[model samples]
Structures are given as C-alpha cells and as structure tokens.
Target chain A: MRYELYYWPTIQGRGEYVRLALEEAEADYIDVARCRNGESKMMAMMNSRRLDTPPFAPPFLKTNKQIIAQVANILFYLGARHNLAPKPEAARLWVHQLQLTIADFVVEIHDTHHPLGSGLYYEDQKPAAKRRSEEFWDSRVPKFIGYFEGLIGHNKGHYVTGRRLTYVDLSLLQIVEGLRYAFPKRMKRFERKAPAIITLHDRVAARPNIRAYLESDRRIPFNEDGIFRHYSALDE
Target chain B: MRYELYYWPTIQGRGEYVRLALEEAEADYIDVARCRNGESKMMAMMNSRRLDTPPFAPPFLKTNKQIIAQVANILFYLGARHNLAPKPEAARLWVHQLQLTIADFVVEIHDTHHPLGSGLYYEDQKPAAKRRSEEFWDSRVPKFIGYFEGLIGHNKGHYVTGRRLTYVDLSLLQIVEGLRYAFPKRMKRFERKAPAIITLHDRVAARPNIRAYLESDRRIPFNEDGIFRHYSALDE
Candidate 1:
C-alpha cells in the first residue's frame, strides 16, 4: 500500500525518521506536505473533528484507513510491516526502546538552542540557550550518545541490534548527521569518543536506498526551523 | 508471570506510569527499586555490559526473559496482555499513539521546572524556569492537554479511546494529577478549559484498583525531585 506522510515541508525534523524507514524499505509513499496544496490538506486532516483517531501532531503516516502519529510510534508501525524490525516480540521492543531513547535525545538536542521555550525566538533566549548548550555537551550528549556507543561495542555488530539494520540504526544516522550539522566544532570532538556510532552512521548513509534518498530533492535540508539547527553561539 | 519493574526509588516519575498500568491490570509485579537492596540491583542491571539488551534508563519491566523500557513501550506490552488495549491492530495503535502523546506532554511538564537542563538544579535556573513555565502554561499546556480534551469530547465516551478504559486514560489521570500538583494556580484556570479531561481524570482516579494504588505506599507522593514539582515561583 502507498503511504502518505504528513509533516512540515521545509525541514527534516522528526519526519526524517519516518522518511528514512520508508526509503530503506523501498515502500511506495508520498511526502504529503511537499506536494502542491498538501500542507492545506494536512492541516485540514489535523483540524478535522470527524477523525476518530486524529493525530496530535504531524509526522503522521496515513495508510489503510489509519493515521499513525508520533515519530517512534510511526517507525514502530513501519518497522513491523517492512521487515526493518526483528521478528521476535522481545527484540522488536528493544529496538523500539532504543528509538524512544533517541526521541528523548532529540528533545534535549533541540532544547540546546531553545531552552527558555520553543514559542520564543532563539534570539530572545540566546543567553539561556548558551547555558543549556554547555550543559548539553558536557553531560547530556555523552550520557546519551555514549550509551549507544557502548551498545554498539557490546553488540559487536554493524547495527544497533546485531547485524540487522533496524529503524533505530536509521535514526542514529540522522542523529549523527544532525549533530554534526548543528554543532560542527563540538561534534568533531565528540566524534572521537563515539567512533562506532560514527562508523554506523557512515554505513547507513552509504546504503544504496538511503544514499539515493539523501541526494534526492525530496530530502529536506536541515535548517534553523528544524530540531537540529546550526547556531555558532549554541555550539560553542 | 511476575513482572519486575526497575526504576528510581524516590518520586513518582516515569516509573509511576508503569506502576499505574500494573495496578489497573492487577498484574503481579515488583517495584524493584523500591524493595530492599533493589536500587543497587537496578543500577547493576543498567550498568551491566554482559546484558544484550540493556535499558538506557529505568522504569523497565522484566518478565518472561524480556526487559522492556520506555513507558509507552511497557504500557503497549502490558496493555496487550491485560486487555487494557483494543483487539484490532488499528485500534491498538491508536491507543499506543495517545500514550506516546502523553509521554511528550510529560517532558514538557518536566521542563517547565527545569528548562535550562535537567543537570542544573531548579534553584540555578529559576529565572529561565519562570520564563519557560509562562510559555508552557500559555502555549504548550493548552496545545497538548487541549488535544486530549478535544479527543475526549469527540469520542463522547468515559475514556479517551471510547467505551473501554485504555492505558491512555490512566496516563491522562496522571497528567491531570501531576499538573494539579505542579501548577496549582495555572491548572485551576486551565482545568476549566479542559473539563472533559478533568472528568476523565476523576473517573480514572475513582476506579477501585487505581484508587487503592493511589492511597497505598506504592504511589510515591509528588515532590520537588520528581517530574512534577511544586515551586511557587515556577507555578506562577
């Protein structure tokens, strides 16, 4: 079945996680918000009071009479259907757990530039952002990314969950790429401690389907409007 | 099967969500961290390198040789086994989607008190916390909580998913209670706009199992250390 993905057209944001899975699986899908009049359609569906299972936010996948929302939840659905996750229930839950941890990390990474509140401009919260960013790199980043590094070392495999590439690995690729773009100088130093994560990131990036998708125009460039933004002040 | 839940000893943090589900299901489980010598065991399990699937953090359930982390993931597992979720794949996904939304709301609420970073104490980030709390009460709270309110109104049932009480309903109860504890002044006014959510909260609270759990020592009191902390400064 062809899937319809609803998200902001301008930036990868959380939608990129879903996009990576669909691309990796070679699934037929449409990036709805990128299509002409698609944003309006997405808003209409979101605002539609008639929808029984209305999504709380975007990055929802619509297919077969169901609208699934939340990045991890969407990935969970796609992973089960597309052979991106393991067959065993226990192993599948483990991968989803890692994805949820990635979700938490994403929030922390975004807060580095918008600590005071998302409603406020980064310019308005620059001082607070700097302070938060300092804490993020000093404590949060290592705590989170290091956990994955340890997992990779322990698993002794190219992927997070053994040799198979699950959606978690796809997300880790996005995390590495996003961090590098958002905090080039800091990520340069951080990369030294997480060679395994970097290696996995490179592997996922070089995957034929993922490589094609990354180079395609459908892949939205990372921008300040997205979760991972390049701001020199916050980076340093 | 007896489930062993690993989480922090203090505070009704994320662990409480899992605790609620177990209570509602009347499932046999041990709050590992709360038991004697349990905290050390929890930390050992977390820091163990030999374990193939180590949890990034606590509030994980170990049962039938599977360790499930992430509150939504654990609830998804328990919901299926305990009849707390629907039978259909689409319906079950809808319930899980709502639980994931609740997870996001929890992060926002936690950040209202610790916006700069969780590493820094509330005392250190008081001004930033005030600014973040203002935006949270003004924009975030309404957007997240109101979505659930709207869903309840649209569902026109006793629960968020209609007719049957799902884990989402239990989480909504926790959100209402936590918000009331954390931001009494703001929530007093906010609750007026979310009467349906408040109603669902009360209904869930009045359930025999949940009420018993809330009254028992198993339910940790909301405190300064947990996700929902009452600081008069942040509340206003």
Candidate 2:
C-alpha cells in the first residue's frame, strides 16, 4: 500500500529521516505535505479531532488508517514493514535505541540556532546560539560521533549493527550531510575522529535507491529554515 | 528473569521514567546504580566492550544478555514484555509516539535551566534559561499539555489509550510532578487549561504500585540536580 508521509514542504527537516528509509526500500509513498494543498491537509489533520491518534507535529505517517508521528517511531514502523531493520525483537530495539540517540543529537543541533525558543528567530537569540554552538562543537558533536564510532567498532560490521543496512545507517548518512551543510568547517575538523561514521555515510549514499533519490527532485536542499540551518555567526 | 537498570545514582532524572514503569508493573528489577558498589559496575559496563550492545548513557536496562538504552526504547521493550502496552501494533506504536513526544517535553524542561549546554551550570546559562523558560511556559507547556488534553478528549479514556493505564500514563504523571516541582507558579497558571491532563496525572498517582513507590524510599526527591530543576526565576 502507498503510504502518506506528512511534514513541512520545503525543509529536509526531521521528515527527511522518514524519507530516507522509505526511499531506500523503494517503498511506494507520497510526500504528502510536499504536494499541492498538502500543507493545509497536514495542518487540518494535525488539528482535527476525528483522528483517534492526532499528531503533535508534522513528519507523521498515515498507513492502514493509523497515523504515526515522531521520526524514530515512524522509522520503527516502516523499518519493520519494509525489511529495513533486523528481524529479531532485540536487534530492532537496538536499532531504535540508536535512532532515539540520533534524535537527541538532532534536537541539540536545532537548539544551536534556536536556543531561546523554536518560536523565536535566530537573530533574536544570536548570542545564546553562539555560546550554545561553541559547547556543541566543543563537546556534544564529538561525544555523539565518538559514541557512534564506538558502536561501529563494537559491531565490527560494515554498518552500525552488522553488514545489513538498518534505518540507523540511513539516519547517520543524513546527520553527516546535515552537519556538513550546516557546519562545514566544524564538521571538517570533527570528521577526523569519525572515519568509520564517514565511511558508513558514504556507503549509504552509494546505495542505488538512495543515490537516485539524492540526485532526483525528491531530495530537498538544506536551507536556513530547516533544523540544520547554516548560520555563519553561530559556527566557530 | 530479573532486570538490571543502570543509571545515575543520585537524581530522579531520565532514569525515573524507567523506574516508574518498572514500579507500575511490579517488575523484578534492580536499580543497579543505587545498589552497593553499583555505580562502579554501571561505569565499568558503560566502558566495557564485553556486552554486545553498550549504552551511550544511563537509564539502560540489561536482561537476558540484551542491553537496551534510551528511556523510551527501554519502556517500549518492557511495555511489551510486561503487557503494559496495548495489544495491537498500531496502538503500541501510538503509545511509543506519545512517549517520544513526552521525551521532547522532558528535554525542553531540562533545557529551561541548562539551555547553553549540559556541561555548563544552570547559573552560567541563567539569562538564557530565563528566556527559554519564558517561551516554554508561554508556548510549549500550553501546546504540549493542550495536545495531551486533546488526546484525552479524543480517546475518552481514563488513560491515554482508553480505560487502561499504559506507560504513557505513568510518564504523564512524572511530567506533571516534575513540572509542578520545576515551575510551580507556571504550572499553577497553566493547569487551568489542562484539566484532563491533571486528572490523568492524579489517576496514575493513585495507582496502587505507583502510590506505594512514590511513598516508599525508592522514589527520589526532586532536586536541582535533576532534569526538572526548581529555579524561581525560570518559573516566572
């Protein structure tokens, strides 16, 4: 069945994680919010009381009459359905744990630009953002990258878990791309300690379906409006 | 089988979420870090490569050789094992989605006092925290509580799902308690808009196991060291 993926139309935000998983599996799905009048539909669905499971925000997936939100939760559902995750319950939980950790990293990245509030502008919080970004690069980025690097080392596999490509690998690719786009100089310095992570990112990019999606119009460009905004002042 | 939970020994931080779930289920588990010499064991396990899946942070659960991390991921596992979650896949995913949303709110709460960085002191980021906390109370608290309020209205359930207490309900209770402790004035003002959510919190607290646990010595007192820190300036 074709899936309906709801999210903001323009930004390769958290919604992009769900996109990568679906694209990798070559699954039939509509980028619902990207289509004409889709934003209105998304807003309506989010505000509607008719749905038993109303989403708090965008990047929700509608499949089989069930609406699932949260990037990791959506990926968890699609991963199982599309064979993107391991079969065993334990392994799937591990992959999901990785996804949750990645989710934490993503939130931290977003806060670098919007430290004051998501409701506020970057210009309004420039000072705080600068300070926050300093700490982000100084500690958080390395800590997270090092953790993933450790995971790769522990697995002794081509991917995070093993040879097979799990949804976490796809997310890792997104994180690398987003970071490189948002903090090019910082990532260049940080990449030194994450050779395995970089390799994993490249390997995921080389996958046929992912490559096609990246090159095709399906992929959205990184911009200021997205989670990983490129703000020169915020980056050291 | 008995479970081993590794987390920070002192604070009722993220670990409390896992603890609440275990307590509600009356599951056989050890708060590994709280036990004698448990902190050392937790640290060794965190640094050890012997385990197939090493956790990046605490609040991890070990059972039958599988180490699961991330508060939501661990709860998802335990919810299924202990029959704490709904039976159907769609319902369970919905429960997880709710938990992820709660996790986001918890992060926001943590940042209210530590917006600059986790490594930095709340005092170092006091000004930023004031700004962040303002936005939190002004927009986020209302948005989140209202969302849960709407969920309750939609489900027409005593709990988040319907007539049954799930892990999400236990977490909601924690959020209420934490928020009340962190932002007493703000929560007092905000409670007017969230009657349903407040009622749900009360119901969860009134649960036999949870009531016992909260009154027992096992429930750690809320303090500045935890995620929901009490700062008078942040509340206003």
Candidate 3:
C-alpha cells in the first residue's frame, strides 16, 4: 500500500525519522507536505472532524488501515511490517525503547537552541540558548551518546540491535548527521568518543536506498526552522 | 507473574504513569527503587553489563522475560496483557499514540520550571523558567489539553478510546492532577475550558483501585523535585 506522510515541507525535523524508515523499506509513499498544496492537505487532515484517531502533530503516516503519528509509533508499525525490526516481541520492544530514548535526546538537542520556549525566536533567547547549548554539549550529549556507545559495544553487532538494521540505527544516523550539521566543531570532538555510533551512521549512509534518498531532493535540508539548526553562537 | 519496576525513589515523575497502570490492573509488582536498598539495586541493574537490553533511564518494568523502559513502552506492554488497551491492533495503536502524546506533554510540563537544563536548579534558571512557563500556560497547555478535549468530545465515551477505560485515561488523570498541583491558579481558570479533561480526571481518581492507590502512602506526595512542582512564581 502507498503511504502518505504529513509533515512540514521545509525541514527534516522529526519527520526525517519516518522518512528514513520508509525509504529503507523501499515502501511506496508520498511526502504530502512537500508536494504542491500538500501542506494545506496535511493541515486539513489534522483539523478534520471525521478522523477518529487525529494526530496531535505532523509526521503522521496515513496507511490504508489507519493514520499513525509520533515518529517512534510510525516506525513501530513500519518496522513490524517491513522487517526493519526483529520478529520477537521482546526484541521489538527493546528497539522501540531505544528509539524512545533517541526521541528524548532529540528534544534535548532541539531545546539547546530554544531553551526559553519554542514559541520564542532564537534571537530572543540567544543568551539562554548559549547557556543551554553549553550544558547540552557538556553533559547531555555525552550521557546520551555514551549510553548508545555502550549498548553498541555490548551488542557485538554492526548495528544497534544486531547485524540487522532497525529503525533505531536509521535514527542514530540522523542524530549524528544533525549533530554534525548543528555543531560541527563540538561534534568533531564528540565523535572521537562515539566511534560505534559514527560507524553505524556511516553504515546506514552507505545503504543504497538511504544513499539515494539522502541525495534526493525529497530529503529536506537542515535549517534553523527545524529541530537541528546550525547557529554558530549556539554551537560554540 | 510479578513485575519489578525501576525508577527514582523520591519523585513520582514518569514512574507514576506506570504505577497508575499497575494499580488499575491490580497487577502484582514491586517498586524496586522504593524498597530497602532498592535504589542501589535499581542503579546496579541499570549499570549492569550482563543485561543485553539496558534501559537508558528509570521507570522500566522488569517482567519475567525482559525489561521494558520508557513509560509509553511499559504501558503499551502492560496495557495489552491487562486489558487496559483495546484488543484490535489499530485501536491499540491509537491509544499508544495518545500515550506518546502524553509523554511529550509531560516533558513540556516538566520544562516549565526547568527550561534551561534539567541539571541546572530551577533557581539558576528562574527568569528563563518564568518565560518558558508563560509560553506553556498560554499556548502549550491549551493546545495539548484542547486536543484531548476535542477527542473526548467526539468519542462520546466515558474514556479516551470509547466506553473502555484505557491507559490514556489514566495518564490524563495524572496530567490534570499534576497541572492542578503545579499551576493551581492557571489551572483553575484553564479548567473551565477543559471540562471533559477535568471530568475524566475526577472519574479516574474515583476508580476503586486508583482511588486506593492515590490515598496510600505508596502514592508519593507531589513535591518541589517532581515533574509537576508548585512553584508560586512559575504557576502564575
């Protein structure tokens, strides 16, 4: 079945996680918001009274059966269907748990640049942002990345779970890429301590489908409007 | 089989969501961190190298076979086994979706008083907290609460997912109670607009098991350290 993905057209944001999963699975899908009049269509679906399971926000995948939102939830569904996740229930839950941790990390990363409030402009919270960014780069990044590094080391696998590439690996790739783009100097230093994550990121990037997708126009460029932004002040 | 829950000993925080579900189901469990020397046990298990699937943080459930972390993930597992969720896959996914949304809302609610960084004390970020709290009460709360309100309106059921009381209902109860404790004045006015949520909160609180749980000492009192803190300045 062809899937319809609803998200902001301009930036990867959380939607990129879902996009990576879909692309890796070679699933037929449409990036709804990126198409002409697609943003309005996406909003209409969200605002529609007819939907029983209305999504709270975008990056929802509309399948033939139902609409799935939340990047982890969508990935959970796609993982089961596309063999991106393990067959065992316990293993799937574990992968999903890791994905959820990544979700938490994403929030922290996003807040580094908008600590005061997402509603406020980064310019309005520059000082606060700098402070938050400092804390983020110092403690939060290592804590999260170190946890993953340990997991990878213990798993004795090419990927997070095992030799197989789950959606969690896809998300890790996004995290590393986003971090590098948003904070190149800091990420360069940080990368030395997270060799497994870097290896996984490179591995995922080398996958033919993912490689093609990354080069494709469908992959929205990272920008200030997205979760991961390149602000020199915030980065340093 | 008895479940072993691992979380911080002092605060309700994310663990409360899991506790509510276990209570509602009348499931046999141990709050591992709350018992004698339990906190150290919890930490040791988390830092253990023997475990293949290590949780990134607390509020994890150690069942007979495997451990499940992430509040939403644990709830998803327990919800299925205990009938706290629907039988159908699509319906179950919808409930899980709502739970993930609640998880997101929880982060925002927690950040209202700790916007800069979780590591930094609220006193250190008081001004930023005030600014963030303003944005939270003004837009974030309304947007989140209003989404649930509309869902309740359309569902025309006693609970979030129709006639049956699901884990989402339990979480909504926690949200309302936390909001009332954290921002009494703001919630007092805000409650007028979210009649359904308030009603659902009361209904869940009145449930025999949940009522018992809330009244028990096992239910930790909301404090300054928890996610929902009643800081007078942050509240107003």
Question: Which model is ahead, 2 or 3, in terms of DockQ?
Answer: 3
What is the TM-score of candidate 2?
A: 0.98
Give the 10-residue window scoring lowest on summed lDDT in candidate 2 chain B: B47-56
TM-score of every model versus the real structure: 0.99, 0.98, 0.99
Restricting to chain A, the TM-score for each candidate equals 0.99, 0.98, 0.98
Q: Summing lDDT over every window of 10 consecutive residues in candidate 3 chain B, give the lowest-scoring window.
A: B110-119
- Chain B TM-scores, listed for every candidate in order, come to 0.98, 0.98, 0.99
The weakest ten consecutive residues by lDDT in model 1 chain B span: B227-236
Candidate 3 Cα outliers beyond 4 Å, as residue runs: none
Mark the regions of model 2 whose C-alpha exceeds 4 Å error after superposition: none
lDDT of 1: 0.92
lDDT of 1 by residue, B160-180 (tens): 889999998998898889989
Better of 1 and 3 by lDDT: 3
Q: Write the per-residue lDDT of candidate 1 for residues A105-207, one digit (tens) a residue.
A: 9999889989888899999999999999999999999999999999999989889888999999999999999999999999998899999999999999999
| Model 1 quality (TM-score) | 0.99
List model 3 lDDT by residue over B115-233, tens digit each: 88988998899999999999998899999999999999999999987899999999999999899899899999999999999889999999999999999999999999999999999
Q: lDDT tens digits, residues A13-102, model 3?
A: 999999999999999999998889999999899899998999999989999999999999999999999989998899989999999999
Candidate number with the higher TM-score (2 or 3): 3
Q: Which ten contiguous residues of candidate 1 chain A have the minimum total lDDT?
A: A87-96
